[model samples]
Target: MTSPPRRLPGEGTAHTVEQSAGELARLAMARMDETLGWYRELSAAQRSQVGLVAQAGISQFVEWLRQRERHAPSAISIFANAPQELTRAVSLRHTLDLVRTVVDVVEARATSLAGPGDEQLVLESVLRFSREIAFAAAEVYAGAAEARGAWDARLEALVVDAVLRGEADDSMQSRAAALGWDDVAGVTFVVGRAPLAASSPDAPAATVDSLRRAARHLGVEALAIVQRDRLIAIVGGTRDPLPVVEHVADRFGPGPVVVGPTVPHLFAAGRSARAALSGLTAAVAWPGAPRVVESDELLPERALAGDLPARRRLLDRAHRPLTESAQSSQSPLLETATAYFEHGGSLEASARALFVHPNTVRYRLARITDVTGYDLTRPRDAWAVRVAVTLGRLGGTGATPGPAVGLSDAGQPAPVGRRGLEESSNL
Candidate 1:
């Protein structure tokens, strides 16, 4: 083509460099546009996060352009007249720089999400990341009117999550402060239980979700936390522990349920709940049906209740040895002796109580000394024998221990017994 006008080799190299630079500039502009689009999709917290990075990137890009202006080629004037193109180039360069910084922030936040030690900090970090993501997405969706609706929805979600976390934290702090953790408080109740294995098809998700839904149904607002195959909930604003315990048991099934005592406030509630759980564990292990247990209910009988079968556990632990000893059993002597001894060593009373002859009651009282070498005449051992026998009769088999399965206020058997015992106790 006319010898190509005899162009120099250096001219070809310069032209190639200009073309490469223009392509880089175009790519930078595209990135800026994409970033702006992403920004609109971000939440308030996310916008704040990206805003810092955006400022730094913009500053660097401006300084770079100013430096380049001193040596800019004459042909670059063409872009000068194209303000839109120039603006896009500047925006893109800034966004690219910010993206690098944002990546680092996101990674750090994700890492900390697993085990953020301070509860408050954990909440704050969630808010911070939410903000970052919202802002980044907004940058990506910037100036795209047709797709703006979709980005707006996403941004709304991000903002909601950020705000919700902050509210939850503030609410927690306020509740804590009021409970006198700000001053002082007693044991904390940490109410929780390990979730049982899913019972049926669709039960796992269905059970948990149903419980959450039911809280609303019951007009109860509380936090539901799932941890280690367990659902833990903290409830505030109620002094009546019984109703809540009943309500939860009714909802969650009867598997070893426990309700901790209401402490002075929320701060101490965690400890109280843990203690209550321990009692529930012991009760479930004790025997009988799945029962809702309480900490205070078990304290009286815990001492000797350790390994006895359910029927015998409460009686045996609450008193001294009541049942027949092995040697005394050979002669029916210990049982007879205990009965007579429990009758205040009164032959007539012991006979009437046992539906036996007074002679037989006296004869057994004599054998008590022979079999175990315990003189029923001694006041202390006689008292022990009396209490033990009473407990045995109270907790005897072929009978129910009444509905008083839990601890009494004084760490004693619940004052209310059944039948004659119940009637007499009531009197």
Candidate 2:
């Protein structure tokens, strides 16, 4: 067999450097101090930790050169010898700065330290090592970021759960603050069907991410959770939540999406959550409801479903306002509205029943609409009015069926006519 090939000068120098690894490490550390401002910015403990890392890196480089024929050592593992806490104390950029400084020192000393004709080879190896170190730093930071993101998601889910269960307290607020919810100005809960899991195992998470992305685009804050087949989101930072809801409506699955009224803050978001969840539960009652419907608009359906809060809401928003006006017989707007509805919305019939001209009935209906904010002409508004009237009657308010009133052109009560009495009886 041929005599073993004589070791190259570059190979011999690599062995020499490995024998003096401790000296090379010290030189790298000194250069790090001279070159990097951020290094000096580190605390004493952090700086000592970085020094250990620098030393390990130089020693690892020498070991890799000695074993070059076996296999190149992994540059990433050089950081393994340092305490994991170093990753936190030194940011990726700062870590990269350290790596650059170390590499620069190695490159500058290569000609003097390496055997004849080995300087170029040593410099090339330092370049390769620096590249790998940068990649390793990036991996470390990415992992940390992913871990933080997952923890934040769990905390967000908890906060949403607390709000839904109406158990929001100081601890929940603290958790919310940790998730950066301090700037939220107003809060509203939105509920809709979650995306189907058949499409993807993480479809719920994806849907929530989509909602968050949409909320961000709208310059609002959102915290969402996937509970069974429903996805609920607490949206905040906007007084006018309708536009925000509409902006994010497409993120929810196909169904009626209900938005609760905007509460003043997140702690009061439980009110919005209660209303939104109730609306979502009762949404089936209105099959043709708009894609984005306000929780208050679902009161009639919610009340019909035995929701006491909905019943009270109907009384407050529809029944009480109308009935309060009926306390005075001079304001015949309520009676005219009752006759208008009872007479099948016929202007002529209501006019005849009220003993007034059609124009007078029209004027009274206008006044009623102005007071109640419910236009009698619209079918949905008509349904709300009818439901309110029924609820008022059931509540023993005597606010329904509109007491008969005869009105003259001067807008004061006039004596009832026999014809009007006959027409009223027919109604």
Candidate No. with top lDDT:
2
Residue 315 in model 1: shift from native, Å?
15
lDDT of 2 at 346: 95
lDDT, candidate 1, 219-328, per-residue tens: 54333333333344444545555555456654454365555666665444534543453455455544642355555444333322432232243344333332444344
lDDT of 2 by residue, 10-37 (tens): 6679777777678767877777778778
After superposition, candidate 2 runs with Cα above 4 Å error? 1-59, 69-115, 198-200, 328-330, 397-427
Q: Per model, how many backbone clashes are there?
A: 39, 0
Provide the overall lDDT of each model, using Cα atoms, as 2-decimal numbers.
0.42, 0.75
Highest TM-score model number: 2
